[model samples]
Target chain A: MSHPSPRRTRDPARKQAAILAAARAVFAERGYENATIREIARRAGVTHGLVVLHFSTKEQLFVAATTPDPESLFKGVLDDDVTKLPERIAASFVHRMEASDGADPVIALIRSAAGDQQAAKALLQTLQQTAVDGYARVLDIPDLATRVNMMGAHLIGVAFSRYVLADGPVAAMSPDELIARLTTTIRTILFD
Target chain B: MSHPSPRRTRDPARKQAAILAAARAVFAERGYENATIREIARRAGVTHGLVVLHFSTKEQLFVAATTPDPESLFKGVLDDDVTKLPERIAASFVHRMEASDGADPVIALIRSAAGDQQAAKALLQTLQQTAVDGYARVLDIPDLATRVNMMGAHLIGVAFSRYVLADGPVAAMSPDELIARLTTTIRTILFD
Candidate 1:
């Protein structure tokens, strides 16, 4: 086979990045049932076939585009100092959610899940597998699962109120205030 | 003018009740945007004009169907015993949420809000006007607004996790257990 040029190799990667970005926008805007592959491909400036080639199905594409790598996400927050975990976790969550470059995937999942029971189940599964389980392993505490569940529930609530609902005092809070408040509440859930 | 028959007076009340019930079912099943006035009328076995005559608009009908009388709701929970407020509030919320007769109106609001920003705003406004403000006035604590926001956020999160997402340890929790757990959390938020 002829040697591939550098441009040829770079084209696939560039095309994929474009497609993923477009997918996130479409999914966030229209949710699951309303979102279409044609729209995503058109927005990405790629052929629909290329999108299908890269990700065989819409579900696969949605999962790939919306899911932050769990390993990296957990590693960043799951530091050795148990005393500081609450602050680190709360700050990290607030920062990721407030990131302006891309839509927050968890919020997108929640919006979509609101109308779709299947999506809601998938979101819960994703959170359990990624957040709750990760926390359980890291935190040395009794009833770890229940504690993690409460912690996850509170964070999810703050997210729904602050990001999804986007109103009320919770939504009006400055990021630092939100982080500080959440850290205190999270610590209570974990330790108190 | 001739006195109207008793049946004529009762007909309007009965028709209004039917329409409200049907509206609730349709809104819960199809969400806010997807629900149709015609469908609600059909389910109620009435003409579309009747639904409009009673409520004037789908928005009004939605508010009628999903909103419990806030006065009655608050009266039940906002008792004089400040020490028991956490338990009373938590238990009241869990009971109303677990009511099997009609759909939980708050959950309906939340689900509908997920797909619609305007609906989300309305939810926040309703909660702020009803739950947060009511709690603030009764709790008699410093920074009551912020504390109520935190309490509301945690409760909303629990609702989403248990009622909406419907999985995990939170979902599996018995009503008594949930109420107990929530009372502790709410008390901490309110007092500690």
Candidate 2:
């Protein structure tokens, strides 16, 4: 029997990704409480049922949308070489955030979390478990959790000011300058 | 001439102060766009007409509310003694923020500005002219604006995480630890 054409088959992975991309956009614009499944589906050019099938609920979709793929985002930044890890991580983070065409998912997550206690708790737990814990494990330093936490606060603060808030001097700075300047502060946190 | 009973006489300054205080609380709670004059008037225990007479419009009220009293907040942090400026600033900021029983006007301004371009622009301008310029004047460094900007980002980031987002480790950090750790990072940004 002749197999159906590959193009004719619906790729679940591709469909899910489309839904997530739309969800991210919607969530970023409207925040979690205001974003609706129908709106996300409309943005994705998919049926509402398809989105529901993939994400099950708005909270599920939100969690999926806001959650960063830490491995991909931090590629090699958390590796064996603890030296320059701060610089590398800061560079990678700023690069990723600046590369985004619209609101960064982290900013969206933060904005959404600000209005919702439950979402905020989940977001913090996810960050602690994923990024913070990963950094601690890779670095294997004493009081690594606190270090990672401080590092995150610094990075997020810069990101919030530069990207989210669009502060004048911050937004005016070139990416290289930001990475370089931020690296110095990050280094102190990680090393000092 | 004997002044009429202070309680009966319309003390414009006292009335204005009450209205501004109420505006700050309302703005902090609902943000600028969402906050209403009627609500602010109600909170201030005055008539809506009185609020309008005092501030003219919600926009004006917001500007008034979010504006920090620089002298109270900055104090000696912006003085000629630049050696401990970072530590002093960090300490004063954290102390003021922690001491507040309700939403911080700075945090409220930030959250409120996130969605409003005009508000964001005004906020940035205020910071540049106030905190940044103050630091530049005191520090006398060529790149003092950038340095102060970085310091702001770091302090805001820590404040945002610890107070706004209530990140676990950041919030769990004792005031002394938070101040000490943040002072170190701020020192790097300011002097290093």
Candidate 3:
């Protein structure tokens, strides 16, 4: 077996990071259906082989690029004081919107899932494992699962209006307004 | 100009209705991207010319087929007693889900809007003209527009979870359960 050359081995981690960032941009711009791996590879300035090596398929790449670190997000939300949990959750969502500069993975996943079965599965799985299960695990209340799911539904709608549709009053609100509007309702969904 | 024969004189209204129904099914099954006018014509048993004659473009047909009569829906929702208005609104949503037999036009619109700009515009316009404006016109409250928009956002999210995602606890709820869960929250968003 031939050993890899120094050029091939040099800064693999940096190359992987570059590919992920490129994938996110391409997915956001072209959407899931129109987004291509070759385009992603070209944008990343990496060979097609390298992109394939890092991400076996476009679906996997799409998921990886669009999905937030659900674990970290939920953990941070839950780790806060219970009285402040809703505020923290709202803040985290705003932080995600700001961090992504409006290319939110959850919104992307929802948009792609609108037409693609695989994306739909990824969306359901992500929400279930992240928001629904994450909240249910910590909060003990009657009809917790249903309430959490409803909360997820509400947030998904808000995201759709503000980000996807990008019109109407919900879309017009500032980030501070968004957080203010959502915090009370989110609290109501979880606790009341 | 040549006079049309009796064979060409079939009920125009009936034919238009058939085409719209076929368009809805095709759009629902194939979504906006993959759904074809040709297939819709075939399903409707009309010539492609007839389909085009009725709806000039796929986008037009998509808008027509997927958009509920916002005027009627909101009029009906608003005409009721103010005390039971929330329950009526919730019931109307459930009634829509039931009437469509699971191929919900609003959900289809939301799903398509996720990836398509025109659909996004349609979703926004429909919500703004129908729900936001309708509610704001009827209810005199502080921040009425923002409150109504938030209410729209919440309903859109609930519809997404229950219909599009189809796997969460919200999805598993019965129609009555859905109405019961949604009524209180919607009331809160509008009134509180």
Candidate 4:
């Protein structure tokens, strides 16, 4: 029998990356409960068994898709000077939403969580503990958890209304205007 | 022909009010699409046919249930002095949420809208025009529409996170504290 081609045994790392990218897109579009492993595998150009082998379960795949690298999401905002943190964080969130063509993964996660109790719990934990709690410590303000939570809720609300709901006036505002408006609000919550 | 009893000929207005109340509860619990006409009728102690006679269709019933008297929702917030508008609005929203035991009609509307495109469009129109735009006109500030929309989004986010998702820190925050923090954020958005 002829030996299998080397191309057929391509890099495992590249294959895994492709699967993850496909999972994010699929989950973002159809949500966690509605998105199936088969569809994700098809989108990734891999077999269903391969997806199962990698992610093990739909929940695991969902967690992978929605919980992107926290560093990537927060980036320089976390390490910046304390006083200017609000502006930097606001700018970073707005820039991230713009870069993604206004379909932030966090919004998708929130939307998906609306229908499922377990999903909602997962989202709350991810956001409250992993995201907001960490930022609260870095800021080192009294009652910072409440402040961080409120700020996050406001930012998420803006994203949902402006991007997902596509409210006319909100969607019409320029990026500079949005960043400025958001920075003001964030400053009030974080510093004031 | 024998005359019918006066009790059998119940007051149409009273019956209509009962039906609407039941519709609100059912729709709030089960959402617009998931709630059935029969269940609403059962809750109202009326026949399904009577519900149809009053509301015409499921869509109409949903509209009636969610679109409570605007004055009831906003109360005195719209007419308050511009300087105290933020605190008044924030207090009113938080108070309404507490009054409803966290199952506010607006939150129900938002949850229903998450799964249906038509429902989402209807909600956006109701919120943007009937609520935010009206508040914007009252405020008379430049870009007040954006401000009102952002405020609405933030309040909605807080309600969802605190009441719907029941986030620990958000849920634990007292109404006074919640209103206070929200007032500061609203002030930043509206005035700063």
lDDT score at residue B91, model 3, on the 0-100 scale = 93
Q: What DockQ would you assign to candidate 4?
A: 0.52
> For model 3, how does the per-residue alpha-carbon lDDT over B91-188 read when each residue is reduced to its tens digit?
98888776775556766666676456786577557655666667765677778888877877887777777776667678788999888877888877
lDDT of candidate 2 over B1-192, digit per residue (tens): 476532343778867777788777776666555678998877776789988887787777777777777677677677776787868887888888898744566676555643554664576567556787566567777887878777777776776677776767888988988889878888888888
What is the Å distance of residue B143 in model 2 from its true position?
0.8
For model 2, the stretches where C-alpha displacement exceeds 4 angstroms are A1-11, A49-57, B1-9
- Number of the candidate with higher lDDT, 2 or 4: 2
Summarize candidate 2's per-residue lDDT along A13-50 as a digit string, tens digits: 76677788888888767656667999988877778998
Off by over 4 Å in 4: A1-15, A101-103, A133-138, B1-15, B45-57, B133-138
Question: Order of candidates by lDDT, top first?
Answer: 1, 3, 2, 4
Candidate 1 Cα lDDT to native: 0.77
Interface RMSD after interface superposition, model 2: 2.1
TM for every model, in the order presented, reads 0.88, 0.89, 0.87, 0.85
Best lDDT among the predictions, by candidate number: 1
- DockQ of all models, two decimals each: 0.61, 0.54, 0.60, 0.52
Chain B: TM-scores of all predictions? 0.84, 0.87, 0.84, 0.87
Judged by DockQ cut-offs, the docking class of candidate 4 is medium
Q: What shift in Å separates residue B154 of candidate 3 from its native position after superposition?
A: 1.6
Q: Which 10-residue span in candidate 2 chain B carries the lowest summed lDDT?
A: B1-10
Return whichever of 1 and 2 wins on TM-score.
2
